[model samples]
Target chain A: MALPTYAGPLERTWYYAFRTICGLIFFFLIAPLVVIVPLSFNAVPFFTFTQEMLTLDPAGYSLKWYQDFFGNLNWHGAVKNSFIIAVFATLISTTLGTIGALGLSRAEMPMKTTVMAILISPMIVPLIISAAGMYFFYSKIGLAATHIGVIIAHAALGIPFVVITVTATLVGFDQSLIRAAYNLGASPTYTFFKIIVPLILPGVISGGLFAFITSFDEVVVVLFVGSYEQRTIPWQMFSGIREQISPTILAVATLLIAVSIMLLASLELIRRRGERLRGITPS
Target chain B: MAAATTSDGALTTADGIPLKASLARAERRNRNRALLLVTPLFAFILVFFLMPIFDMLTRSVDNTVVGSVLVRSVPVLSQWDDSSGELPSEAVFKAMVLDIQDGRETRTIGKVGTRMNYEKSGMTSLFRKSGRRAKQIKEAPYKEALIKLDKKWGDINTWRLLKRESDAQTLTHYLASIDMRFNDSGEVVRQPEEKQIYINLFIRTLKLSALITVLCLVLGYPISYLLATLPVRTSNLLMILVLLPFWTSLLVRTTAWIALLQKQGVINDFLVGVGLIGDDGRLAMIHNAIGTVVAMVHILLPFMVLPLYSVMKTIPPSYVRAARSMGATPWTAFWRVYVPNTVSGIGAGGILVFIIAIGYYITPALVGGVSGTLISNFIAQHISVTLNWGLAAALGSVLLALVLALYILYDKIVGIDNMKMG
Candidate 1:
């Protein structure tokens, strides 16, 4: 809103000042993210800007660190491991969580609130406790150090997100549509596949993406139950930071930052599309 | 005849089936379908999540090692009355020697020693040192033989501590987690001055987490208000600023902070270049509490903002305008009308931010140097480095309890079913 005419100086000052304060906060939010992009391209293996970089010299920027990150077999292995764990974990969490959401939205579900609290507890519990408990428990059950174990552990952690997103989509759903489709002589399975799946597809896919990201970003559990075979990107970065702040890490960080922006963009588009489909879009 | 016909009319379906039986079948089928849909995930989480948490809680109370190895001594020692303010009799010492020899032969003595030492300091060495020399003793004055091996054996308190901790189940790990220990005379007592570390760490964790929550509120509240008040076109563009960090890899953000806060990092270098400080006088920020607070506030600010923004969006601007039109000043109108409506939002955001901050692990571990560390770091140490799973489990249980308590509060104030993802 523009400044109003016939306002006192004090009122006008407060409006401008409020906007300025908000502007500073927005800058604070974005400054750190903006700061890291330039530093990742420094010619020297330094976190600070070199004189040459400040002067915009031709030799001031390099892709050597990016090369190092891509060329390292360990980094490649970590990327591969991350994909393997994240893919299986996303599939399990999305399927199971969608099913759970379906149950919870039903009118006849028993002890629905209590079961929901139980389902969401994994997200509420601290990572350390879950990791420690899983460490001991998995070892005893002969699940520790195996890919299947990490995948399952991550899937458990990711279920809450899936249930939350999918259940939200179900809230806007018209339950009558299911009955209407079934009344046309279509089977229950056919009605579900034809009606419900299409309506909830965006939520399902977005929820699956969230689950994938949760597993991708997870590190503490891997540290506890995983051996060398299960190191993901975050795990590698964690160890890399603890041992030495290699510039290659900065390059990888930059790359991950790009991935996050892409993910955020896709989620925003999915949300708008879902809202339109659910008949809530404003003109 | 009229009442019976009316009852028959009410109970029958249009298709001639009894309505009571048909409706009951439908309800049963719906319930079963719901259960069928939920069973796979319910059973999965039960095995992977709930069971492990239950297992960890039990570890806090599990006491099996000491009794298994010192089998003969525990019962005999229980019979001796150390309340007379003297060491147990010759019979107790003979039993102890026999138990140690039994433990040594089976090589379970070290395990027993380790378990006992967790209860009383230096007890493990006494056992270890005595086990080596117990083999040379071949006589009836075993009491003198043991006392000569270590003067600690002559103390009645040591024997009392031993007997009290020998129960097949105990609370030792939980006690240690809270920085309390059973004293020599067998009463729960505060740990001595130098040994009082865990309680202080717990307090520091709480304080730092609270500070981070407050910081997030201070920074996020105005931003959220702006996002809510602005036209949708501008606010939508500005929303990415909040979501960017929310979606960014946590490590990338943390690494950025490290690079910006280190002594040779961006902020320091900028300050030094601008003559704020000498090059040699670079400020220490990243590896301490300041680093932890700054980085965490940045990371968690979105959590506070998102909830507050959602709540504020629903509150109409007309309330403040009406209050203003009534001759109240803007500040007065805001304080009386606007802030009260946002209480639920504040509760939701504050609880969410605080709960997350309290259990934070990676940020503090990376940026928090010696004095900056939270309790999660120590929990990590015990789990991986120290190999004290029981103590780690106890620490974890306490942290989990804190989170769950706040979680219940959040649910009461803001329904857990309302928790959502962007």
Candidate 2:
């Protein structure tokens, strides 16, 4: 139900109290992020407000931190590593997860619920257990501390997100379309590529985006399975803070935040388009 | 015409007109295609997911030293008063002592001690000493030597811990992690009153999780409500704002808090500038519970808001108006009506926040000083610093058990299937 915005005197007071409290909290939630965007371009390096210093003071407006972030080999390496791992992991997880979703959606497989639960368990199970286990198992096969090791580990973690998003999209899918394609003598592979893939492209893309983000942002698992050569941005950021808190990290954070916002916006667009493709308008 | 049709039907029985075999082959091909489609995923899971969990569970019961040592002393230790939890026969104790000592001399004690220390402290030294010079227990001067090693040896509790260890299988590591000890008489009992630990840490973790969950809900609920009600454009913008932090890495966010919350950091600077307290008054933000709560809440609020918003969006406004028109005051209407309807959302959000908070490691380690560290921190220490996988696994098992228990309870109370927060 639409919440009551106004009421009798006591009710009105309660309403205002709730709204005021909510507004304050909303500000608190967004404040840290908001602070970073401006601080990224701050004339002064310190996080503070100053009076009447809008124009580029010779020292204040320097983009040296940003320059260092892009120019430093360490930072550049981390960024490249993160993107490579994220892209590869996302592709593997989205492809497998979508195929799994299609199979489960159409068939009345035995123990279907259990299979689904098992697929999603990675999301629920604590990372430490998984990380420790992976460490031991991977070490035996000489996969530990390798880039391929980190990618497989991340893809495992990313698989659940892909499954969840793609499953949701597949829920309302029509079976009759598949039957029609079969009736027209189209091969199943041809039908999937020409019909099902385009129909569920939104779900697939959204799922892929989440998988990419999940792998990009993951640190705890990477921390265990990876060593120096495979360090991603978050892992680097972690050590950066531990060793020294430089403004260069701030520059990195601001850049990462910008990239994340752009990715999320694109995801939202994909969601909107998928909804439209499915003939469901945004409410 | 009828006679001709009958003759034609009789002639059409076999190969020329039928495509049944082709249809059957096509179905077989479809089945094979499905199998081909799913095999890659199955291979990935087998290699990556299932194998790891199998390895982890194996470590849970991995009793390598005790297993190898079983044949050497099981028969000799047989004569001891196991029920009294009394110290075993001198020979058996001697064998154990020698084993422990030899284990120590060969540095096997360190490896075996990893499992025993998980049960209780000082076990490695006791076992190593007994193994090396255990035969001396038969000598007349045994009491003095025993007492010299540990004054508690004179008491039955100490002997009880030893007697408990004689078993072929060991729960000592698992039980001791939770602060329960075996009585010498061989019954499991609460760790003697003085040594009970980890319980408090577990409690503290729970309380911390509850506190963080509450803080997130208190802060996130109204914003979620507002976001749900705002014009679509505005709500979408606000939602993006909520999700902005999520795009960045968690390590980055926790580090950001470190930058913001340090003693000479912006928070302290702001407090000093505002005259809230003296310039000398350093606000205890990071390196303590306050810092942990603040940083955690900031990171976890999105979990709360997204669920709350999804639930809030579907709720039509007409219910509130209907309540208002039917002789109910607005305040009464909201308190009785709106809030209860939002319970599912709150429940979904609370569960998500609590589950995530319990598994928190990085934020607590980075921001939480000794006093602020949670149980997961100790589990990490057991693995990383101490290289004690047995204890680490036991502690992890405990944490895993608790999380699973809470999950089961939550599911029973409000079916997990009924809750969704994306």
Candidate 3:
């Protein structure tokens, strides 16, 4: 990355300019996220920083927006629904995804490419199309507006993440180990729980995390498939932004960011552990 | 068919089981287990995901509502040809009167009017007024009486529109979605100027997506280059900045943009304090196309950076160093030797970002004010408020088709199996 010793003044200027541009671009990536945390604590019901905030006065900040978020029943209901739906969706998607990936990982599996494409189509297809489709179909089956419907729809969307991550993990699995377990007189089920599960636990956990986050963050399908009783946090935030611009949403956004940070950190740790398990090292 | 057999003249496995029957059963059992494992989720997705979309697309052309609502009159009206531009006979008008009365009695006649309004404006009030008046008249000269009630009933064009939209399935909704519709004489034609919004919105969406792709490349190239060229320790530390937003909640990121870019927002406040702009001159940044672009670029930047960074990291730096050592100037070596190598990354990043940006709804709906709503918003509008699911379905199909085509191209360029997450 160092410049040549014989560089002219023009070259030196351009080099510094290029680095400055990159610095600004990096700042652009992080500044919005950083700016909102402080703004969410504003004492006034405004998005901008007040003069006192700039002067570092303690009076300029308050937790009233967070208080508002907690006190409001609509927000409370949405948060509750978000967790309930996400948990069940994660459960279904992870269970189905693990088994599906196991089948897909088999070298003997027929039409592997076609099946992979079919399983992952939910991810590739646009959410609007998927939402529109589910909206009509769920209503037809009398599942529209039900908690189970939204969960099922979200699970469908989450399945691909599980399949992709779990399949990636399964790629490094040694099939000979399974054969050895069976040859040693262990039951097929026992071999799976004892041998396969231990090796793929990290992938399964990470895949479950992906499924959970996907369900939690989803809004489009919920908008179509969910009724008033099934409103999720993202759904509420969507109507909030649409109907009213308020600081309560900013507060919730900050809290959601905290949750994401936790999820991302866990994923990073899982990736490292998975790599170690697979005997992979950075080049 | 012949099977491999042991010297004992019996089909058998190496372990001495019958090879022909045993091998076939084992293979069948293996396939059954695989199919069993996939069946639950596959059935779930087939029922919940694919079925609804297929049903929705089918809804785009489903004209059953209008046909059924005006069943008695539609067949009668269809007999009147456009050759003479003549109003239908009194029997036709009487049938229309009976159908309108029956529709109002059943409380389903409003649907027919709504369907016709989607085809021709002002048909809503026309149906409403006639339905109310149709209940009052019992005269034999029903055509004149109906015309006297409202002159629009006498117009052949209204009857033509009614007959055109009376089919059990029609392409009217699909045509309307693309800013085209059938004229009164049954010819395809452009919609009126005021209603010609969707075609422009589609064009604008493509243009903005392209612009965002360009913006992503411009801003992301330098950042990816820095990350790729810097020491591993520094690059790894810097990589977190890119991944944080990548994993962050989309609504949170959009809200962050709103907080930063709205009128009286942080950026405006800061600029006002710094005397860069007057207090009244606060930039309208958040509720316009610019807001959509700025926030979308921020949200989608990581997508561009990850692919570009991955590709750049794989390219050996020695190639450029060798080019320079061989008397290629730094500029020449960088462009001719270095830039071409990142083409794969650019293609991957560009296509991924463009496809996502085209289908984006939340950010655009929130920050993109009236003038900024993309085609996806319009589809959502028809789905929800307008209650025109047919048009919504048609628009959705177009979008779905467009995305699938682009995805196929992307798969061709960069194998889907090679897609990775950081």
- TM-score for chain A in each prediction: 0.96, 0.92, 0.95
Positional deviation of residue B93's Cα in model 3 after best superposition, in angstroms: 3.0
Worst 10 residues of 1 chain A by lDDT: A274-283
Q: For candidate 2, lDDT tens digit of each residue in B206-272?
A: 9999999998888888788788877887788778768877666677677678767887666787788
Could you tell me which 10 consecutive residues in candidate 3 chain B have the lowest summed lDDT?
Answer: B1-10
For model 1, residues B311-352, the per-residue Cα lDDT tens digits are 999999999889988999879998999999999999999999
TM-score for candidate 2, residues paired by index: 0.84
* Winning model by TM-score: 1
If ranked by TM-score, best first, what sequence of candidates would result?
A: 1, 3, 2
Worst 10 residues of 3 chain A by lDDT: A274-283
Over 4 Å off in model 2, which ranges? A1-19, A38-58, B1-43, B69-109, B113-168, B183-187, B192-195, B408-422
Q: How would you encode candidate 3's per-residue C-alpha lDDT over A1-283 as one tens digit per residue? A: 7787988899899999999999899899999889989999999989889988899899999999999999999999999999999999999999999998898887667888878877888988878888888988888889999999999999999998888888888887899999899989999899999999999988899889988999999999999999879999999999988887789988999999899889888988888887787788842
Q: Of 2 and 3, which scores higher on lDDT?
A: 3
Q: Looking at candidate 2, what is the lDDT of residue A162?
A: 78
List fnat, each candidate. Answer: 0.81, 0.35, 0.70
- Give the candidates in order of lDDT, highest first: 1, 3, 2
Cα shift from native, residue A232, model 2 (Å): 1.5
